[model samples]
Target chain A: SQKTINPNYSNRGMTLEEDINESNLYYLTNGIAVIHKKPTPVQIVSVDYPKRSAAVIKEAYFKQQSTTDYNGVYRGKYIDFEAKETKNKTSFPLQNFHEHQIEHMKAVVKQGGICFVLLRFTNSDEVFLLEAKHLFPYWDESIKGGRKSIPKKIIETIGYHVPIHLHPRIDYLKVIDHLYFNQ
Target chain B: SQKTINPNYSNRGMTLEEDINESNLYYLTNGIAVIHKKPTPVQIVSVDYPKRSAAVIKEAYFKQQSTTDYNGVYRGKYIDFEAKETKNKTSFPLQNFHEHQIEHMKAVVKQGGICFVLLRFTNSDEVFLLEAKHLFPYWDESIKGGRKSIPKKIIETIGYHVPIHLHPRIDYLKVIDHLYFNQ
Candidate 1:
């Protein structure tokens, strides 16, 4: 018996992370943007240094990030954003974002940076770039006895639908260009 | 015999890292800027999850960062830089910078972001913010049969001396404001 390989094996269930990372790499290589996903924060409790080699971390724990996931410079402006994916078809749950992330976004917006969330409806394979300003109202509403989720209908209306492209899988900057730069 | 505690125990002989971290925190709290030191990259080989609050990383190695250590948004612009300390009094060695960092800086500068190196001469207790534009020539020269280090006198003349203050210990943005923002 021989192993049968599926035609779409490589990309059968490509993750949102993989898509965005590929897009960022594409943007970086083309000199279009200088975006990067900040490395995962870890708290190292102990380390052992070998004689001639690098230090080996013996004990560590994952630390919660104080800021958003991805951030960088684009066209002389600061770009900050968080990327999230949901399996639900109807709405994106508010639980995906932390209070600290919201605060970080608020700070980023306060400092004149473009802040947004790249929300992916994994089931639908649709992506949207929702601005931080739009997110705040919903986030605040949730805290004050409002709906705990943003309906897909409202997101479809308010958020720019990001199209997936060949070179850049998720061409989010195209949406940003249209929304911010008008070009 | 009782151990005598020095009055300047906390402040005396503070490393450049401590000064910058304090300054960044101050800037963040004051809403002046949103700068952060990127977390140290770690390549986790094993993780142990014992049905606890957090996953513990058991075995990991420090990963070399592909980009600079510090980056953030400041006054609607992308700010990116690396902080380095040198004990040598006469010159700043070119070997301190990796090729990847130089490439990253070049990419950032090309994208119209503010890029620089925060260099500290520990012996002299002096710090300088040397712009990426000024650094490239010396970097290129070193590759083309030129001096492997930038002389102290040259750095003193070209780079902006970052003044240490009470609130923000290493007030580097002040130099940026003077150089780039015309404030």
Candidate 2:
């Protein structure tokens, strides 16, 4: 029997979370990068052992981490980044980022690692790779009553748009190339 | 009243975990490294909302992670490692490691990041920094019916013993310098 292809798959049916996960898998399968979403840290207060199969955690609490998600290595350079998506079309809000994450990116940059943000605008179906250096101004200005959002024109000027691909789906390395390698 | 001082304050009172945590904190505070123990990951199945401000997780399960305990950047180098403490003085058992963690370390190394294990023997209060490259052969041998343990003598020869100090208790970076940087 001929299988009916789901129409949603043809479009960007996947959420930003799913797309980034697919992108990481793509990187892994191609041996291009070794990035992973750091699991949400939790403090376990109690656990239950059931027949030695696997210990089950019975009581836990979410922990506040000092860093952002997705950090690893690429081409002998440390790669540390975070991904966030918003449905708004006008601008990306600075409030989406936390202070500690900004400090972490600064630390990574000071250590000479590649640091950036993967911003996805679902409304326009655009994905941008924004360098941490460009992000610093908006972060600094927001503290002094400047607009809490980064205008689309600013992102379009400074960020590289990641093209969608059939095989890898979210082929972010191509954008990384244009932004970092000038390819 | 002035606090009574014990002469043994620097001799011994802290646990192995405390020493390592203190060392990690020192590294982080000094901006030397960003490594941290990943708090246990858990899946919350139910939660009790006691008040508007408190949401307590009532039921949860431990989630198996596909990576190691500590990972971050150190001096422009991506650092991924694990720490284990054992009371046995004769040897450090191979069973202390998980298969997934070994695989994760291999991936980290392939991506040009430093991967290693920090083994502390609580009985002798000695901590050794063992590079992943040296550990791999023993892991392979264990699978081929060899002794499932890394003997103290072998560890002494191949691993650099981390010296504990008052400020930075675990000071594994000093050992890393001796092993990796040849300093």
Candidate 3:
């Protein structure tokens, strides 16, 4: 019964991924955007094929995603980003992101795609949209033995605040429109 | 083992997927494009987490993809497509495409994204890049008692011939550039 329950974002207990997925569904249904979370990569080592039933994956392991979690077409531009939430009250840990994902975001930015990250502070329920360009310097500094986490105070300065809404729960596209389209 | 062999495109034995993968890698390496094949969707049912080892997926099944197999950005545009190879020499069967993939293509096209399908006739070793707009009419007619397949001759007229090359084996972006960018 609990598994069949419809996702309701009225309660603030929903994870960041759930909130974004619901928002993406709303965007898709309204013809506003077509963003989707990429499927988890799995390495299927062996499978069993029954004569009359569906094939079953008997052995498999999860693989590292080579790119960001979410990407799609929005307003004729390529949209790509990773969504992360932190429980820490003071800073967002850079360890939440992998080095390969950073490189992938750089590639997306080089191709002129709209690349960004959605960082949420779970304690305060605050979400910010930080562009990939603004994040590169932090990543570069971390490799040189700089701080491995970004202070919440600095994040608020450079990132756009994404206010939550009822229809599209996260409403990150509004932030994109304001930052890029001047709408 | 044969699995360890390096992918060499000088010969013609490689599948359409392999060709496109190598092409995407070349494009990514050269900063030409950022296309990637989406991983196969799997519905995980159970997992076994050993204390000292990786979490192993104990039960899973393949899930039908709701979108195309491949998508990414190119020249600041959202590019999306599905690739299928048929052994038939005279016609390409429409059954190879799922209903939801067509719907997904329609959404991408509406968003002004470049959407198309790569049809490869394995018998004749020919590949054609047919835009989603061009394929829609045939799909519509099929539901109203029209032919369930597109003739190879018709494909030649309606689609662009993707010439094979050494570095980027498929060279599908050339067709995109010529048709969309007039380059």
Candidate 2 residue spans exceeding 4 A from truth:
A1-11, A43-59, A178-183, B1-15, B47-55
Clashing pairs in 1: none
Q: Cα lDDT for residue B57, model 3? A: 98
Largest TM-score belongs to which candidate?
3
Instruction: Sort the candidates on lDDT, descending order.
Output: 3, 1, 2
DockQ of 3: 0.78
Best by DockQ: 3
lDDT of 3 at A121: 86
| CA-based DockQ, model 2 | 0.50
For candidate 2, give the lDDT of residue A174. 73
The TM-scores of chain A alone, one per candidate, are 0.92, 0.87, 0.93
After superposition, which runs of candidate 1 have C-alpha atoms over 4 Å from their true positions? A1-11, B1-11
Q: What TM-score against the true fold does each predicted structure earn?
A: 0.93, 0.87, 0.94
- Give the per-residue lDDT of model 2 (tens digit) for B4-28: 2233434285776677778888887
lDDT, candidate 3, B95-144, per-residue tens: 89988999999999999899999998886667789999999999878877
Candidate 1: tens digits of C-alpha lDDT, residues A72-146: 999989999999999999999998999999999999999999999999888767788999999999999998989
Q: Taking the tens digit of each residue's C-alpha lDDT, what string does model 2 give over A1-183?
A: 112223344435687777778878888878888888888877678878889677767666776666878788886668888888888998999888999999989888887778999888877677788999899899999978988999988898888777666556667777666666688
Worst 10 residues of 3 chain B by lDDT: B1-10
- Residue-wise lDDT of candidate 3 within A1-183, one digit each (tens)? 011112343426888999999999999999998999999999999999999999999999999999999999998899999999999998999999999899989999999999999999888777888999999999899989999988888888888778677667788998899888998
True contacts kept of 1: 0.93
TM-score of chain B of 1: 0.91
